[model samples]
Target: MVVTRFAPSPNGSLHLGHAFSAIAAHDIAQERGGRFLLRIEDIDGERSMPEKAAEFRKDLAWLGLEWEEVPAQSTRLANYEEAAQYLLHEGLLYPCTCTRKDIAARNPRMGPEGAVYPGTCKGQSLDPDKPAALRLDVDRAMAGLGELSWEDEVGGTQIADPRPFGDVVLVRKDAPASYHLAATLDDAADGVTLVTRGEDLFSSTHVHRVLQELLGLPVPTWHHHPILLDEEDEKLAKRRCSPSLADRRAAGEDGRALARQLRMGEFPAGITQSNA
Candidate 1:
C-alpha cells in the first residue's frame, strides 16, 4: 500500500504552504486507497507548543483531510537514541563541540542547507564531558557504498550524493536526534511508502537516502512537489509570519472550497506555486 505522511512541526500555526503539502499527501493516499499518516515533529522542546499540534489537527480536519496519527518525535526519543548509538558504535558518528559561531568564522563553503562545517574537531581529543553535537562521518559512511540512488515520483531516479553536506549532524547537543536521523527513522517506523513534501527539500533526500542505507531502514519513494510561494517568490514560512489557516478559518472562510481551489491550481491573491 502507498502509505504517505505529512509530518509537520508543532512550533507555529499551519500556513497555506503547510495546507497545500498536507492536502497533497492526503489526496495521494486517498487516490491510491492507501493510508495517510500524521506525525508531529515537536522535538524542539524549547520552541514546540503543544497547543499548536492540537491546532494542526483542527486545521487538517477543517481542510477535509483525514489521517492516522503516529507517535510524535518527542515521544520517539528512545528510537532516535538507539539509532544514534548504533551509528556511534559503528564509528560512523563523532562528537563535535564546535558552536555555530565557531563554524561560521571559518568561512566554510556553502552547501544545500547552509555553511558546511569544516572538520575542526574530526580528530581532536575533545572532552567527553563537554556538551557536543554528534556528526555522521559521511566520507566513511559512503566509502564502500558506491553508486547509491533513489526514485522520486516527480524527478524520477536521482543519484545520491551526500558529500556536500559535510558530516551532517545525527544528534544535537540539546536534542536526542537531528531531523536527518529522526525523520528517516520515523518514516521507516511508521511504514511510510511515499514521502510527500516540498521540492525545497529535494536536495536533503540525498542525505536521507544515505541514512536509510547506513541504518538498514526500508527505502521509500519520494515525491517533492512544488512549494507555494508568496508574491515576492519567497516560500511561505512560519518564521516569515505568513498568513495561517487558523486566520482564514476565523474569518469564516470555507476550508473545503479553498482546498478544492488549491486542487485546481487556484491560489489566493499574492500566492502561487513553484514550477513542478
Candidate 2:
C-alpha cells in the first residue's frame, strides 16, 4: 500500500502553502486508498513550540484532511543517533566545527541551503570532546553509491547529485538531527511509499536520497508539487508573515470550499501558484 506524509515543523501557524501541501498529500493517498500520515518536526529545540503543533493539527482538521499520526522527531533521538553512529563507524561522517561565520568567510558559492559549506573541516582531525556538528562526506558517499537516481511522479526519473550542497550536516551541536537526517529516517520508519511536498524542496531530495543510500533505508518516490506564491511571486513562507490558515479560519472562511478551489487551481486574492 502506498503511504504518504505531510511533515510540518511547529515553529509557527500553518499558512495557505502548508494547507495546499497537506491537502495534496491527503488527496493523493485517498485517491489510491493508501495511508496518509502526519509528523510533527519539532526538533529545533526551544525554537519548536509544542503548542503550535496542536494548532497545526487543528488547522489540518479544519481543512478536512485526515492522517495517521506518527512519532515526532523529538521522540526519536535514539534513532537519529544510531544512524549517525552507523555512518561514523563506516567513515562516511566527520565532526565539523565550522560556525556560520567561518563558512561565510570562505567566500563559498551559494547552494540550496544558504552558503555551501567549504569543506574546511572535511579532513581535519579534531578533539572528540570539542563541540561540533556531524557532516556527511557526500563525495565519499556518492563514490560508494555509484550513480544513484530516484523517480518523481511529475518529473519522472531524476539523477541524484548531492555534491552541490557540500558535506551536509547530519547532526548539529544544538540539535540532535538535521532535517536531512531525520526526515529520511522518519519516512522509512513510517513505511512511506510516496513523499509529497512543494517543488522548492526538490533540491533537498538529492540530499535525502544520499542519506537513504548511506543509512540503508527504504527508497520512496517523490512528488514535488507546485508551491503557493504571494502577490510578489515569492513562495509563501512563515518567516515572511504570509496570511495563515488559522487567520482565514478565524474570519469564517469555508475550509472545504477553499480546499476545493485549490484543487481546481483557484487561489484567493494576492495568492498565486508557482512550480518554480
Candidate 3:
C-alpha cells in the first residue's frame, strides 16, 4: 500500500505553509486509497512544547485532514541511537568536537546549512568522555554506495549528490538525534512509501538518500511541492512570525474553506506561492 506522511515539529503553531504541505500529503494518500500518517517531530528537548503537538492535531483535523498518528520522535530515542551506533561502528561516522567558532575560524565554504564542515575532526583521536557530535563521513559513504538517485513525483528521476552538504551531524551534542538521522529512520520504520514536504527541503533529500543507503533502509519517493510566500516573496517560516492556522481559527475562520483555497492554489491576501 502507498504510504505518505506529514511530519511537523511542535515547536510552534501550524501556519498556512504547514497547511499546504499537510493537505497535499493527506489528499495524495486519500486519492490513492493509501495510508496518511502524522509524525510529531518533537525531539528538540529545549524548544519542543508538548502542548503544541496537541494543537497540531487540532489544526490538521480542522483543515479536514485525517492521519494515522505515529509515536513522537521523543519516544523513539533508542532506535535513533542504535542507527547512529551502527554508522559509527561501520566507520561511516566520527565524533567531532568542533564548536561554531572553530568552524568559522576555518573560513569554510558555505553550503545549505551555513559553512560546510572542514572535517577538522575526521581522523582526530579524541577522548571518548569528551562531548562531541557524530558526523557522517559523506565522502566515504558515497564511495561505498557508488552513484545513487531517487525519483520525485514532479521532478522525475534526479541524481543524489550529497557532497555539498559535507559531513552532516547525525547526533548533536545536545540532542539524541539530529533531524537528518531521526526523520530518515522514522520514515523507514513507519513503512512510508512517499515523502511529501515543501520544495525548500529538496536539498536535504540528497543527504537523506545517502543515509538510507548507509543504514540499509528502504528508500521512499519524494514529492516536493511549492512553498507559500509572504507579500515580500519570502518563504513563510515560524522564525519570521507568520500568521498561524490557529490564529485564523481563533478569529472564527473556516478551516475547511482554507484547505480548499490551498488546494486550488489560491492563498490568502499577502501570501503567494513559489516553487522555490
Candidate 4:
C-alpha cells in the first residue's frame, strides 16, 4: 500500500503552509486507500515543545484528517545512534569541531543549504574531549554510487548530487541526530513509500538519497509540492511568525472548509503559491 507521512517539528505551531502540507499527504494516502502516518519531529532538544505535538494532532483532527501516530524522533534516538555507528564503522563520517562563526570567517562558498563547510578539520585530529558534530564525508560516501537519482512526483526523475552540501552533518553537537539522518531512518522504519513535503526541501533529497544508499535503506518516491508564500513572496515559516492554524481554530473557523478551499487553490487574502 502507498504510505505517506506528514512529519512536523513540535518547536512551534502549525501555520497555513504546514496545514497544506499535512492535508496533501493525508489526501494522497486516503485517495489511494493507503496509510497516512504522523511523526512528530521533536528532537530539537529544549526548543521542542512537547505540548505543541498535541496541538498538531488537534489541528489535523480538526481538519478531518486521520493518521496513525508513529514513534516520534525522541523515541528513535537509539536507531539514530545505531545508524551513526554503522556509518562511522564504514568510515563515512568524521567528527568536526568547527563552529558556525569559524566557517563564516573563512567566507565559504554558499551551497543549496547555506555556506558549505570548507573541510577545515578534514584530516585534523582535534581534541577528542571537545564536543564535535559528526559530518558525512560526501565525497567518500558517493565514491562508488555513481549517477544516483530519485523519482519526484512533480519534477520527474532527479539526479542526486550532494557534493554541493559538502560534508553534511549527521549528528549535531547539541542534537542526537540531524534531520537527514533521523528522517531517512524514520521513513524506512515506518515503511513509508511516498514521502511528501514542500518543494523548498527538494535539494535535501540529494543528501537523503546518499544516506539511504549508505545505510542500505529502502528509497521512497518523493512529492515536492508547491509551498504557500506570504505577501512578501517569502515562504510561510514559523520563524517569520506567520499566522498559525491554532489561532484560526480558536476563532471557531471551519477547518474542513478551509482544507477544501486549500485543496481548490483558494488561499487566504495574502497567501499565494510559490513554485520550487
- What do the candidate models score in CA lDDT, each in turn? 0.92, 0.91, 0.92, 0.94
Over the stretch 1-276, how does candidate 4's per-residue lDDT look in tens digits? 999999999999999999999999999999999999999999998999999999999999989899999989999999999999998888888889999999999999999889999998776543568899999989988898988889999999999999999999999999999999999999999999999999999999999998999889999999999999999999999999999999999999999999999999999999999962
Across 1-276, the per-residue lDDT of candidate 1 in tens digits comes to 999999999888999999999999999999999999999999986889999988999899999999999999988999998998898888888889999999999999999989999988886543678999999989999997899999999999999999899999889888888899999999999999999999999999999999999889999999999999998999999999999999999898999999999999999999989993
Tell me the spans in candidate 2 whose CA falls farther than 4 Å from its real position.
none
Candidate 3 to truth, TM: 0.97
Q: lDDT at 80 for candidate 2?
A: 93
Clash pairs for candidate 3: none
Tens-digit per-residue lDDT, 6-47, candidate 2: 999988888999989999999999999999999999999888
User: What TM-score should be assigned to candidate 2?
Assistant: 0.97
Clashing pairs in 4: none
Give candidate 3 misplaced runs (Cα > 4 Å): none
Query: Which should have the higher lDDT, number 2 or number 3?
Result: 3
* TM-score of every candidate relative to the true structure: 0.98, 0.97, 0.97, 0.98
lDDT comparing candidate 2 with the true structure = 0.91
